[model samples]
Target chain A: MITSILRPPPIIARMAFFAVLLGAWEWASRMGMVSRFIAPPPSEVVPAIGLLYHDNELVTRFLRTFGQVFAASGIGAALGMIIGWWLHHNKNAGRAFTDWFAAIAAAPLVLLFPLFLVLFGRNASTIIAMGAVAVLPPIILKTKEGLDHVPPVLINVGRTFNLTRWQHIRLIMMPASLPTIFTGLRLGLVFALINVVGVEYLIGFGGMGLMIAELGDRFEVAGMYAAILFVVLCSACFFWFTARLETWLLQTR
Target chain B: MAVANEMISRVTLYRVSAALFLLALWEAAGASGLFFKGVLPSTWFIGKSLIRLSGDPVFWGHFSVTLFEILAGFGIGSLVGVIVGLALGMNRYSGQIFEPVIEYLAATPKVVFLPILLILFGIGVGSKISLAALSCFFPMTLSLAAGVRGMNPMFLRVGQTLNLSLMQRVRMIYLPALVPPISTGLRLGFGIATVGALLSEIKLSNKGLGHAAMQAYARFDIPTMMAILIVIFALAGLGNMLIGSIIRLPGPNTRRLTKDRT
Candidate 1:
């Protein structure tokens, strides 16, 4: 066993850990140690991906969710940057309201979905707007924080070079703050996706969330898991895109 | 100093005006009868409902249910998180293997587990609590593990040199080192716990503030819904502030230690 060794390599340990977990899960499910309804074996779940694909809504739902995430994150990042920039530039406003944004970020802004539903009327707009608002606060908070923390030395150096305000901001402030802003954007995307899918599930809208909810309701356990797997894949793709973009952006500077 | 004080007052003026302007705009929108009738209730209407809600025993009953779920879930999740985080952080091989797994799980939208939890615990407080607990667990664990991993080795060495007992080392060394991460984890965990509980409640529940808000929405009782949302927001804010203040309670030595660790 890996445990008997003083120290197995991390890759070996990781693979072993997952293998053991999956094996135990399969064994337990087959033995009826866990209910089939709740814990369908991985063997069943793996094939269920084909089942959802054959239903033909899988790609459409995936695209629908992806579009909502993209639009919502764009809106949120734009608005958040503007607000955050304003707060950073105006010291007094930052003092007066930074905490408010922080507080809002901490609150479950997803709960405001009912209002969005009323305002946008049970459509894709409702989900998008809710996601955008849910994601706004973090981006705002991070933008301000990032801008505020631009090293004093860097600003002093720019001033010594007699750079114009616009040039200094564009050439110095923007690049200096890109990493933090990207961090905020990533965080905001996570929140936005969660809320978007959650709202879809709650309202049974036309997305993977709705698919998962519907499958669960029908007790199509494996299908529900497959839908969940697609959502996870979607999330992973988004995370990977941001991570690659962040790396590429940072590397250029 | 006087200039700073004047600037502070001016800032306060600006904040007040900004708030009032937004509230007035909301009132105008609500009264204009342009948008859907109940979408934007006037500030006055929300305020009246807030007052009514304050006096309503029924509101309190639902509020307490949500509150209990948040507290219980946060409590259990955080406790387990600290234990598991400490265990993983202490073990080199295990940390290398499992830290990525924990991070991956944490990043996934946890609400997707709602159906499974529902099937396991049914559509009651149990399912909601499980959701909240599940949400809290990841952040708390990640934060604590990071904290433990980052702790200065010299502190452990010093405790050993002093021949400190296990309890004394825990109280004087480990506890101080862990406080900042614990507070951060608490803040993050509690926030998500509230979201999980309320969301699960909204989706399916017999009695809770989330359920009440959904009921009001279904009835087109916009004022009541807004009032409930305000209460939820306030509770979350209060929770964050409480965690903030709790971390600040330790005296200078521990405070310095926290700063140093971070």
Candidate 2:
């Protein structure tokens, strides 16, 4: 048993490591090594998932948050790509605005959420707008980077075929830049989700953020973990889906 | 050279005009009552509010509180990050086992953990600091680990040939090799840390610029809120530039080497 544990397979090693960590957590919580109010055991957290399902609107809440994420990121990604494309084609404009975009991207745009709330009137629209704006800069910057980095050889190949600018862009330019664009999309989506959930938490209404806030307020630590677990799962799913989609799209090449 | 200089000048001219045009459009929108009165405050109103707010001592108090949180959290996070990253990167098996976990955590919206932090640390500066540290930790760790892993074997061999002690090797060879990734991590970590700190403040805090902005929002003082946001933006921009300059000063050689490697 000792040898097996020591020389464990990769999968086993990962599982064993987490198991040990969780076991320690359980032990600490049970033995009063940590406060019960803050660090509830996995035992309590697991059951709290069921409680959330039964008493709280777990599924509906997740769906609502998910909807906002999709709407905001979708708008952001589309706008980002269009603007990035336009900038790539317009050298003067691109040169003029690239540094501005970089500065905006670096800024903590989430601080503008209150202004969004004021404009959009404290609803899901406010959250969506905030998320979209939060995400837009990164996607735009990344898209431009991707397009700019596409190999000159690829463009030459299109030119050798006597391709027009439109054809060349649709075929060679886009495909070459798609990977970088996908990277931007993933980053933007993460930012969007963070902003959306943050707004929900701040506003103290609607979705998983609200659930986490409410549970925390009620001092239901277990329920809060369960809600957070669902959010982590949502994030993992987003990461995995985008990764899979990128691989599939790239496979055609 | 002349053509390039002319092109740069033209670009700058266009950029300035574009910004002025945007301000003009905003002013026109406010004047025309395109939206509600307060929803789209005139640029002049926002500029006036910003000046007035800058003179207010209470606003400075909040600003100082936020600056303290940012610097303290970033300092703690970067120290822990570099140490842990170096340790993990030096070990082969540990890096494999843990890098994926950190990557996953990095991808997740760390704000979700803010509740746990709040519970553990109370509703004050502790939670905000923890949030900033947590946000900064992942990128820094990943960057340093990647740096250490990618270190050339020749460097270590040279250190061995010189009969250098482990501490000497670390100071002279390993540390210099890490400058590029350290700067990258600092740039990325600082950005995320600032966001995390401000977000936590916005969520629940009696002090900080975020709290001040929220107060303005609560009072339906749109102009004040806008002014506060502009302040935050300016501060964030300044921070980014400061990091950029600091990183660029010591980073050119290593950055060029990394660029060549890629």
Candidate 3:
């Protein structure tokens, strides 16, 4: 077990690298080489963490944003999968739809936030809708690609065994498509998280984004940095978790 | 004359049908009064706003500034990404040392640094450009690195057997191998660049399409805001299609290299 842990790299080395960077940042700030207003030292940011923790408002706002992300991702993933599956049934239609859909996917859907706000008002629902809409195309595109790429030979084999359509899909297509579908889910989750934070930032709904905006407005650089750090940490955790999930899935298969 | 009339009639029918369907729905929603007046602006109001905004020089000025920032950031990011990616791919030690750092930074949403950037760059076009570059850099770097690394080892071996010059090998082998990945990265990078530029403008700027929309929002001018939003979306969609087509175009080097290999 110890060797397994050490096999990757020495944790000390990684920690040392982070420490050295932080040390340089602290030194630069103290030496007036870098503006503290622009990049407050970790010393300032660390203490401000306590202030944010004690602020119940901040915690509640974060929870609301989290709730929005979860709802949007859940709904978007379900709808995307269903649509993808439907498209998979018709090859030519799937291709044609994807041709147009890819353009939509590549467009920055955040531009639609105004329309969303107009339709849904300045509320949590709007945030959720924005996240869902932003992520749906990626999820749909990935899911369709996943389903379409399942080997034709496998389908032929299934048919040879006299399997029903549902059975063929469940037993073969799903398993074959799981990796690609997971990729879409990961992308969707990231987009959902981004849209939630972004909508909150722009519309002034309470969240980490709101906290950042509020701190910026107040010129509390340290507090803003702390909030930004929190967001970065959350995103980093999501990235790591999804990466591990992908690895595990690949291995299990 | 009859054939020409038939073609025109079909096209007109399609356009009118879509427009009528949209207008009818909007009119019905507006008449129902189930939602706030601001929530569902009348089609007539939005149409008028769109035409009015199209004639505004101030709007055009803001749009141009935003476009300049996006394009400049994309160019800078793509250059840096390609250079760094090439270096990392060519040097194993640097690749190992820096790959984790790059990945970590990439995973951390760059938007988190917006406040810091605003402070440093004074909420100007510089800040927007910086944000756009940061947003665009990751995908390009990742795709380029993958492209370089994914080159078939057999190609290298063949080049070695032929004792080809370093430059010749690069021109004949590496460049072709890198094209697909570089194209993909550029396409993704361009899209992210637009988003970054727009988001920065919305968050801090006094000008640009995003600012126009934000101003409309503040004043409860929903129709004007919608029009700006539509314009921004159309621009972003066009950029996406443009970059995507460039990437999808078959490179001359790719065909030549593949033929040589076969």
- Model 1, span A38-79: residue lDDT tens: 889888987999989888388888889878988999999999
lDDT tens readout by residue for model 3, B170-209: 7777767677778788888888888888888888898888
In candidate 3, residue A201 scores what lDDT? 80
Q: What TM-score results for chain B when candidate 1 is compared with the true chain B?
A: 0.93
Better of 2 and 3 by lDDT: 2
* Candidate 1 CAPRI assessment class: medium
**Ranking of models by DockQ:** 2, 1, 3
Better of 1 and 3 by DockQ: 1
i-RMSD per candidate, Å: 1.5, 1.5, 4.3
Q: What is the TM-score of chain A in candidate 2?
A: 0.89
Candidate 1 C-alpha lDDT tens digits along B1-262: 9999999898899889999999888888877988977789887889999999999999999999999999998999998998888777767678888887787678777888899899899998999999999999999889988887788888878899999997887678877888888899999999999989999999889899999999999999999999999999889889988999988798776765653644
For candidate 2, write residues A1-253 as lDDT tens digits.
Answer: 9977677766678888999999999999999999888788999998999999989988898899989988999999899999898788799999999888887887777777777777678689998898899778888988899999999998888989999888988999888898889888878888888788878887886698898889888988899998898788777777777778878877876
10 residues in a row with least lDDT, candidate 1 chain A? A2-11
Better of 1 and 3 by lDDT: 1
List DockQ for all candidates: 0.67, 0.70, 0.40
RMSD list, candidates in order:
2.5, 2.5, 5.1
Segments in model 1 whose C-alpha atoms lie over 4 Å from true places? A1-6, A151-168, B161-172, B256-262
Clashing pairs in 1: none
Q: What is the interface RMSD of candidate 1, in Å?
A: 1.5
